[model samples]
Target: MSKDKKRADLDEKFQQLRSMTNSTSANKASILVKASNHIRKLKDKIEKLNQELGSTSTYPNTENEHQQDSFPKVNVETLENMFTVNVESEQNCPGLLLTIIQVFEELGLDVLNAEAACNDGFELAAQGVWNEGAESLDAEIVKQVVIEAIRKWMSGTASP
Candidate 1:
């Protein structure tokens, strides 16, 4: 790419990052710093939420190593009818994948691509599209449903 074209592309990406982070700084460095701070804040919030979820719930251990410590951290972003979702936990989750998939189906999201690991800690990153002609959805709604699924799965109400 030409020098000017590369600069323009960089500026465009910075503007997008500023919008996403709700940063109002005009300087590129400030924008980046603010975006970094925003990410740290999000991580702190997720950790706090996981702690709360784990502390408030108690379940009988059935010899499965994953029963007691399985609060999933979820983050979701949406653009138009497309979404990217991330879910993770510090402990294994035996049946959460199916519950989350069921939530996606209930919300009419078609998984376009997904990567998951459950043998150790649970981690899932997925990109999906809203099914054609389905009801409208947004990032917050998707995040809520995913967290709700995790809670239900934790409570043993949702079986794989």
Candidate 2:
């Protein structure tokens, strides 16, 4: 079927399902029964179409994984200072603390103080240290790098 026709058919089926689901207080059991049956039939037909056209290719088509790589854009600012980050991960992942250390190393940043605890969830407390001769390094740059590195590590891409 043409794309337009397929979309229209899907829309019609969705409308039918919605109307059936919304039919309440009919004062008759038969109306509810009929609506339920119609909805079931529509669902079965949708499932069949999904199987035939392939779930990933048909309706509810989602973006490709490669297209969704960039996320949580970093905000850049002009300043020089040092800061700390405390990371907590609710998901059960082993050595989540080590992952943060790896990110700092990969980013070419010095970790002044670092500690981790991973009983309920992974928690990483870290202070990014910077010393540039007599003057300190840009604080904003340090903050941005540390924040970006933590975000990247969480998203499975810690390498720069």
Candidate 3:
């Protein structure tokens, strides 16, 4: 591309970044600095959240904490038409496993092998193949659908 065109593209990207980061700077350098600072703050927030999860719970809101503890960590990996999925959580809800399986079925995914443990905590690892009918599936799409299913399940179980 030409110099002016390249510069314009860069400027447009910087503007987009500024909007995303909620920075109100007109200068490129200022926008960049603000974006960097914004990223640092987000990292700090995530670190603080991790620390809270690691620490003990002594608060009176045990019910709220219990709900948070049920949120599962989901991972998915794709290789060609095959996907490897793992879901783990500190606490197991009764129907969570079924909910996840429903997502795979809805997406026309066939489970080749799987394991599940729900005695102490909930954990599942499965390898599946995408059937020919539905569009090709990727890791993120599979993970997201499973998460949404879990979220709906949790919401229904939450206390009013």
Error of 2 at 95 (Å): 3.7
Candidates 2 and 3, the one with greater lDDT? 3
lDDT tens digits, residue span 11-36, model 3: 89998878766678788899898889
TM per candidate comes to 0.57, 0.35, 0.55
lDDT of each: 0.77, 0.50, 0.73
**Residue range 1-160, candidate 1, lDDT tens digits:** 8999999999999998887666788999999999898778756655564464454223233455464445567889999568999998888888888999998987789999999998879999999887886643557656766776787788798867
Q: What's the distance in Å from true for residue 158, model 2?
A: 5.0
Candidate topping lDDT = 1
Select the stronger candidate by TM-score from 1 and 2.
1
Error of 1 at 45 (Å): 26
True-structure lDDT of candidate 1: 0.77
RMSD of candidate 2 to the true fold?
22.7
| Model 1 pairs in collision | none
After superposition, candidate 2 runs with Cα above 4 Å error = 1-81, 131-160
Highest TM-score against the true fold, candidate: 1
